[model samples]
Target: MATEIATLGGGCFWCTEAVFQQLNGVLEVESGYTGGQVANPSYEQICEGTTGHAEVARLTFDPAVVSYREILEVFFTIHDPTTLNRQGNDVGTQYRSVIYYHSPEQQETAKHVISEMANVWDAPIVTELSPAETFYKAENYHQNYFRQNPLQGYCAFVVAPKVSKFRKTFSDKLKQF
Candidate 1:
């Protein structure tokens, strides 16, 4: 089946990865670093906020099952796009809200969605919409982090709440167990 890619950074990759993994049409969600100058940047380097990379979740999904617009809609719902270089307690460039569109069509769709979301947010949306850059997959431990370590401190507090909100907000779009 043909698939499309959506790379997004709403906050920590752990949070975004957990949220998107529940979507029915989303085939896969890989946590990674992108929009940075460093090649194959490590998690430590990103955490330092010097690499210019955002902690992004690169999703592969069937567009036939879920439109790009729907993906963006869910994205806007799961995180605070109005904050600049921050999400909740995580404050840094790596945690900023961003969307890396892979195609011209995706770019236009993202633009429209961001505009639509602007009205929904009390503050102007600060989500960065950019052409996709080279994506370096994060370390193995970072992938499916919430699933693997549900009771872990960050996952329990930060990631779980976001996942719960996404499940509640988009219950109809969740994948069947």
Candidate 2:
């Protein structure tokens, strides 16, 4: 089966990872950092906002089952694309809304989706559309965080709400498992 990858950064990677993991045709969702200057930056370094990396998730999906536009549809729905370099209380360049497109087609689709989203939204979309950069896998503990620590404070407070919204909005796209 042919699969494609999509990397996106919109606030904490935990939130994005959790959301994408629930979708059908999504093969794997790994949380990480991308669009950064530093080489192999640690989570601490990226959080400091100097590394220029945005907290991102690398999602591999079966393109035949779900289109890239569908993935972007779920992405834009889950987070605030208008907030530059920030999502809720987490404020920094690393938390910025960004789409690191892997190909020319992905780039065009991303921009078109953003334009469509902009028409529905009154605020200017601040989501960055950049070419895909080196993707540094986050520390081992960061992967599948919500599934591991669903009861944790940040998971309950931040991630839960987003997951709830995603589940409600994209019920048809969710996998049974």
- CA error at residue 75 for candidate 2, angstroms: 0.5
lDDT of 1 by residue, 1-177 (tens): 999999999999999999999999999999999999999999999999999999999999999999999999999999999999999999999999999999999999999999998899999999999999999999999999999999999999898988999999999999999
TM-score of each: 0.99, 0.99
What's the lDDT of the predicted structure labeled candidate 2? Answer: 0.95
The lDDT for every candidate, in the order shown, is 0.95, 0.95
Colliding pairs, model 2: none
**Model 1 steric clash total:** 0
Q: What is the overall TM-score of model 2 with all chains considered together?
A: 0.99
